[model samples]
Target: MENNIASTDNDQRVRGYCAYDWGKSAFETSVTTAIFPAWFAYLFMEANGISMKVLGSEWTADAMFSAAVMIGALFVAICAPSLGVIADRRMIKMWWLRVLTILGSVSCILLALSPYLGVSVGWIWAMIMFMAANVGLNGAGVFYNALLPHMGDESEMDAISNKAFASGYLGGGLLLLVHLLMVTFIVDESGSVQSWVIPFAMASSGIWWLGFAQMTFKMVPEPHIENEMEPMGLIASTKMALGEVKKTLMGIKEFRTLFIYMIAYFCFIDGINSVTALSGVFGIVVLGLTVSGLIATILIIQFVAAPAAIGFTKLAEKWGTKKALQFSLVCWCFVIVGALSFAPLELENHDEYDIQYTWDEGNNTYVATAREGVNNIAALPDDGEQQWALEYEDILPVAENEDYDGGYAVKWAYEKDGTPTQVAVSLNATSLAALEGTMDESRFSYSISGGEFANSTGLGVEHPTSLGDGKLDFIPKTARSLVWEPLGLSVFFQFLLLGVFGGALLGGSQGLARSMFGQMVPETRSAEFFGFFGFFGKVAALLGPLIYSLMTVWFDSRVGIFAISLLIVAGAIILRNVDVEDGIAVAKAEDERNRASA
Candidate 1:
């Protein structure tokens, strides 16, 4: 059965294509989502403390990372359509796919080298390679998706597309499990997970991707063209591709249904991506979820999404791909509603403070509880090290890395047993004046560990009395009082339920959306149209995040989520008008016309 494994009807070729998804998802789930962000942040902080000024604008590690992603997406958007034109005409989609895979995998391997380069250069190297990897991932996707129309007919497209996504989730989840173990168990004598473990993880992800991708290259054959264009000089070929793209643009009316469907695709997909991107940030920043907890939640989503994707294929078989997709979009709307209502329960005891430094009077100790605003928590993956106390003056203390806004030396110190605590926080005039202004009696309260300091000198660190509150605290508080407490669901349980349900919907909708598009595409022109699809996809990637960023800055994170949800609602409305049957008919007719002419 392996003989001529590239046959249109061969299940082996289908396996090969699915294997590619299985392979590449190692990068998506593990490297991009789990490891790279943390690794990059560490390197960036080591090189530039907290943030750096570039062109009078402050850039944090996260901002720089987002910029890199956007840059890669822009590159793919500019080139995808034109390249698709060239690939279709030249019958070289497989060739381009292979080339981009190498580029991406190699870039991943290059990421392993960043730690060796000193901190000064490592972050820059990581950023460049990260962008390069994204370019390869996005670029290869255009060709890979184009193969879907050729993979099977309209009847099978839903199963094939969803199966591939299912394979991706399974493969990614497995690899991420391996990585999670490696990170958790691989520790040194000092109890720190060795720096090399992360680097090894980065390299292993690339190797896994590159190694399994061979199954695709070995078994899948390049699609043959009846009127294949011969290779010409790069300039001439590019010119020809541009002309072909222009002709397709001019004939947009011929594919009016397909175009309409694409418009709907653009909005819903943007909303889905934006929500996925923001959910983690919301969990960490607003809900007090730790990094380990976030990783565990992502793993849960991955496993839950896999079977859910396959289930959607069955649903598509029963209700038609378009209808199935519409159902998923509506479900997504419900998910957004649930997310908006999520609220953390009010804090108890020391949890009431974002960063608390206090005097334990009975114990005669200085206590510090570093929560939301602190960094570099020195503990194992899942340890309750949020609060610690100093019995007397000790060298080891949780020092603040970020100075006050006006730039001053502020060091919190605990003294000998009799004295208990000593506070010499050097403050500039500006910070001192601001602190003095806001130093309301009800706003801050504290007791010196030993009466000697407070009773004698009356000197200590500034501690806000009513703490752990934000500008948007009222939103979660109101929701908790009205919705959560009544339902008797804690925020953690609420988040878990939201993630599992939303992830299932996300998997189903993503697979069904792409599958529906594949059904509408003319077999002869799949690559060309898929190029346009990729262009829109890349642009959507940039646009959705940008919209979330703008809305978050203007209002709150919840408001940003609300804005994105509206995009899905508008898309679902537009989708109702798209005629899937007419689009498929147009595609069949176009393919027939191409065959007859050839």
Candidate 2:
């Protein structure tokens, strides 16, 4: 409302620009990208080894994660508007920001304790912590976003917003890389008790944010708006905020495009959020991949996504935001297709496979003795009822088997009820080594009961495009074959670029949304308009995740990719109609009239 952000002739006013987009980088790294989603899956998925049919039947991991997100966001929707109004009325926005920041940081730190609880109770505790962190993050963002209009006018908005987003990309990518290294190499052990990496990283992020926040608090003085004399209580203020929102919607005619854009953003964002959350679970639980595979894949995503976001930003600017968004959507479609082509399905005759293993007679444990070729059976002592011991350090029970095959059958198994139940399967020792690189430590021990042989087939896609046909591909491979290929070093640079683009576009849109509202709406009720922003953004968070979940549940991991593509497409389409100049003009006039009345 003031000329605090007025441009100078030099255009080098970087003093108060500290409030630029860098602050939100912590939110992206700590809350959105790193901790919550992975933790949720580690805590929640049904780990007792249910039937494959049942695993496919229940809510897909994606859907369940999204549903949790939606439930959490509902609280945000109900409170955001009221909080916005109160913040404005009190003219002490810093106080609210401090409170939210503390709440969010504490919750994130607490989530590290989730792994200690049993599966049933662990999931609930983690979800509650996640919800609290999400609410705090969202609440803080609403206020932070609102400050954009105070930092720059329409002319400088593109530059400031873009820079802030770029900064966020850099911050998020760097932190993720560090965390990945910590989890992969530094953490020498892992168990049900706790994971030192996640909580420590989250706490570190909180410390970083609180430290940086001081710069803005010191430099940016509060706006000089006259306080609303009416001293309404919290309940009364909430009712008033709702009334104002209704009035704003009905009274403002040209706001149709803005509202529509919000709806579109909600739809697409939810899908993106949900898919990201489910990826780890799909890899570990559904594909039966090792923990290392899961970590490596996520690291790939974090690094790859960074540059992809940046490149898309430039593309959006060149072809217009809509075209750029559509391009991202296209990429998403291809990824989905690729994922479906690699869908993991249980093989019939899976129990029958020829594999050779060597047993340590001294310890009664099995070791990877050798593998000859495809369909090779191993020699085992023909003791049918021998109770072979099966062990794998902790938790996930190892199966026992008195049988052996020359092919790559149960990579590691023991006997259960005098029968061999497949515990783990691999193609080769190299594959096992790659997987083992990510875990804390693992031991392989099996008892030799007798020799048994069986043949198994996998339902692999016939072609990349032919996902619907129920087909099987017989290949001499191991369980590691099911894991996605690790993207090479090139992906890291590409991710950096993408991160820049996405950060700029997303940050710019967020800032632009704030600017338009500020410039068009009545100044006396600026808080009211902001409430709408809070409502829309929070709703988008809820809806995006929910849709992603549903799609993954109905189809497979590929469905998540399709949903993400759809969201990018929709966001681009909606952004096309956003005009910042007109909205500002209207808001200025409204403020002028209000001053006259006063």
Candidate 3:
């Protein structure tokens, strides 16, 4: 009867631990991947146009987002190990986890206030809150992971770890689905999204994180510490923590394989983390996908990853964890290459329209002939409009009763000094009809200046030959045309397909990695060692974004993405040196020694 009670309690605790993953995943999916990036991009665009000048450098919204992640990761990397040591000595892992969880959840809630803070400071506030939330998330991860070794025996580690990841995917996916529906259906009279929708979604992620975490708090007891020291003052505790960290570093040779595996884990996980952190922004900036498309793709990844994580456990059982991880890393390499090569070209002509444009060099204004037969050519001023305009381009005569094939679509590609830039938008029949009765020639324009423009129909529309002093003024002509166009696929569909394959590997790799580490970590020193694990992960987190950000600023986003693949390949190479059985032997010996000492 007593054994049965104990088993029930153990199962409940495991469920609670998994529930925390479920709760916090809402924040990961809704705020980090799905809604928040899009919301922040919208706000940034509204406040500062397409790009912003920061510290004398031009930064796109995606660049700024990556920079924020880098900063947050750096802070967490510096603090995680010491905090881990302290929690180990004091039996305060659960308490520390709670504090960090609260911090993360509160920061998530405060993110709702960003838009209300006024356009001038809203983006900055959002960045600050996002960084704080990241710190909290990373900090909490150390303690959360520290609890893993105590949850189950080494034999059960893989299943438990993967279960947690699977639960996270389900939790995050469900919340994301709800948020997607909210955004899709809730719109104002102008068909513009309601202002409160995104903010509320952000707030709900926080609520979900905090609310579900209570299960973990209530069910998972603090791990008992043997021969624990009496609690000391904060400063003294910090000093002791530092001393322990130094001792661990100096004695690292005792656990050679573990440290080596950590280094290998650092490299490959950097690539994986970079992809997850930057994929949403990448979709928006490079693929020119709609926000809805990005969200839907992320939703697909979340659901797909859940099952994949479980499937990976079986793979690990069959092929061993190291081999399974290597396979996933290989898939990741292919994904990155696929992203670099993804260029889609799909433009079908509905009808052709003759448009005449005249450049006024004095005012840098481009005027187009609005009405051809009427001789009433309406001249439109450029006036900083980042869209293509036909002004009063006249349509050819048609039979009064003849069926028009949805009026004419004037497909114009804007060029600055003969280089195509930005996504192309067309002035369709509906837009032309709206501008027909209006004297406002500006109404004839539609935004065609943000993504990779493909078709140049030679409509004779005179666009600005220069973008003044903008940093993106010199985009390589080759980058626009050379990659994915010949594949006969759209970038949006490419992203969807990539997500499908990538998602399959995502959860499995992460789950198996954690389980492998858990199997090799000394149970007695789980918190202390997992702190080192968190340290390596957080530091890797910092380096990945910093490298990608620098590469993006110095070269371009494609180069940055290509750079990430090298990290994975290098990590996989180094991982080949690790012997899992030998590491497990060392861990068992250490655990037995510690218990004997106690």
lDDT of 1 by residue, 1-598 (tens): 6555545446877899899999899999899999899889878877886678999997888899989988998998888888988887777899999999999989998899999999799999999998999999889899999999988789989998999999998998999999999888888764568788898888888888888889988877888789787789999988988998999889999999998988998999999988888888877655655677778878888899989999999999899998899999999998887787677664444434343444556665545433433333322212222122121113123344253332212323223221223333322335334433433422222222233333211111223112224344455667788887788776678788877998798778988988999999988888899999988877887777788789878876677888899999989999999999999999999999987887
lDDT winner, 2 or 3: 3
Measured on C-alpha atoms, candidate 1 has an lDDT of 0.77
**Alpha-carbon TM-score of each model against the true structure:** 0.84, 0.63, 0.76
Candidate 1, pairs of clashing residues: 443-465, 444-465
What lDDT does candidate 3 reach at residue 352? Answer: 16
lDDT of 3 by residue, 1-598 (tens): 9999999998998999999999999988889877777688777766776577889997878788878877787777777788887776677899999999999999999999999999989998998898889888888888899899989888778888998999999999999999889887898764567999888998999999999999999999998878877989989988998898898899989999999999999999999988887786666655545566777788889999999999988888888888998899999998887776554343334121223333334444333332221111121223322222343232211112121122222323223232222221234446445444342322121212112222323311121111112233233223335544555456677789888988888998899889889889988778788878887887787778778889888976767888889999999999899998999999999988877887
Best-fitting candidate, scored by TM-score: 1
Computed on alpha carbons, the lDDT of every model, listed in order, comes to 0.77, 0.48, 0.74
Candidate 2 regions with alpha-carbon error over 4 angstroms:
1-24, 27-32, 36-68, 110-127, 189-198, 227-230, 252-254, 271-527, 548-560, 563-581
Candidate numbers, best lDDT first, in rank order: 1, 3, 2
RMSD, every candidate, angstroms: 6.9, 10.5, 10.4
- Model 2 gets an lDDT of 0.48
On residues 167-249, what C-alpha lDDT tens digit does candidate 2 reach at each position? Answer: 55556556666766665565433312235667667666665555556655666555445644476877787788677656766
Ranking by TM-score: 1, 3, 2
